[model samples]
Target: MNRPAARLLTFQLPLAAFLVFLLFPFYWMLVTALKPNRDLYNLTVNPLWTWTPTLDHVRRLLWDTHFLPWMRNTLVISVGATALSLAASLLAAYAIGRLRFRGSGVLGITIFLTYLVPPVILFIPLSRIVSALGLWDRPAALVLTYPTFLVPFCVWLLLGYFRTLPRELEDCARVDGASRFQVMRYVTFPLALPGILSCLIFAFTLSWNEYLYALVFLSSTDQKTVPVGLATELVTGDVFQWGPLMAGALLGSVPVAVAYSFFVEHYVAALTGALKE
Candidate 1:
């Protein structure tokens, strides 16, 4: 074979296959959402394509379910959690990664170790804490609880990123008599933007898709996140509502998809930087 043809087979064909593999779920969801009930249920019909398309499922998902409220709750919780976690993680990472202190290394490792602990093991105690705080069935509960996992990972990532930053710049600022807080606010924070953006994306995505904590803490239909709401509200026992379910799933994924699209470069750069440390 010609070199150009060989290169095409080696790279382009695999790239195309990988793209299809990643995107097939989305295409299936779109096709299912658009499929008419008759075609959706008909055993003889092609599952991959529908001749007749309808927006009925989308309409049903929007109007018939508490999807909008769920979305709002999810957005509020996700943003709140991400903001809170980032603030805490930033301070913690800066202190551990930059400041010279005893036990800082041990503290950093401990924080990252906390992230490895499974959420399933923590939810029961967290549920009680949420209830005791009278935050049950409220978005604030998730806003608080999500930070448990988010902070540790964010701290770990930011710690690595902070280590990669030039310490000499910070020393120069210090020599100029800039206070620690001022130095961070002016020098380190701006340089750490990529790592911060990566943490924001990770925290937001985790909070957005979290299910167990949402299910345990939020009892109201209006208070649930998309993941919990879609699973519990869309299905009626053994029976499933595939069309509306798929529609809801597709709609629910858009914000996260948009977020990744916008910040993906920073996310990649941050991960690469962190891994180097």
Candidate 2:
């Protein structure tokens, strides 16, 4: 083979291998979720295609656990946290990115830095605050705690995206006798929809998948989001229920995967972040 052809093969081989390696586990989980207990324990290799696929695990996941309630709780906390963070971060990022103020740079840095704060340090204190505020042992604890991370991360992410947009768009709106809020509502926002969507998806997924604070704060069975609730089930006994657990995990990840793919599909439709102003 020619040297260039050989180099191409070397690179392509590794890339293909890496992709297969990453995808194989997801394939296995789907396979496992579809397989009967007997086929699963039958001691087989290449279980993906070898097993007699069944929907029993999926059935049990929906019927056996409080799966719907957990999903609802997750949706509640995720949507609430995302909406709250989106509103607050939009205003804050706009101020920091488009408006001039003394100490704005320092405040922006501080907001970004808040994302790096470990939940371990803050959860305990926040739990106390939640108790004082009468939010303990409820899904509200998650809503409250999630903003600690979501607000900062969204603010930072949107700050960069907002900074890249042309100021002339808002300028034109003002010349048309639009108020600040009107410019944001009618012009600036239309231009920044992509960043807003991205932040919404990011913050929602983060809050949805959050386990630490939810596990620490929420005590009610009906109030626990899917992540913490599923984890609690994973440790009910010495032997883990790997089948149902994987089944639940499979279902749990679907929304997030759909959201990511949806965002990627329409990534170019918005005028922020990935857009070149």
Model 1 local distance difference test score: 0.90
Alpha carbon lDDT of residue 162, candidate 1?
Answer: 85
> For candidate 1, lDDT tens digit of each residue in 187-272?
99999988888999989988888989888888877778899999999998988899999999999999999998898887777677
**Model 2 agreement with the true structure over 98-149: per-residue lDDT tens digits:** 8878889899989888878888888778878989999888777777678888
Clashing pairs in 2: 34-54
RMSD of each: 1.9, 2.9
Error of 2 at 104 (Å): 1.8
State the displacement of the C-alpha of residue 157, model 2, in Å, after optimal TM-score superposition.
Answer: 1.6
Looking at model 1, which ten-residue stretch has the lowest summed lDDT?
268-277
Best candidate, lDDT-wise? 1
Query: Highest TM-score: which candidate?
Result: 1
- The alpha-carbon deviation from the true structure for residue 244 of candidate 1, after best TM-score superposition, in angstroms, is 1.1
Q: lDDT for model 2, on a 0 to 1 scale?
A: 0.81
Candidate 2 TM-score, C-alpha based: 0.90
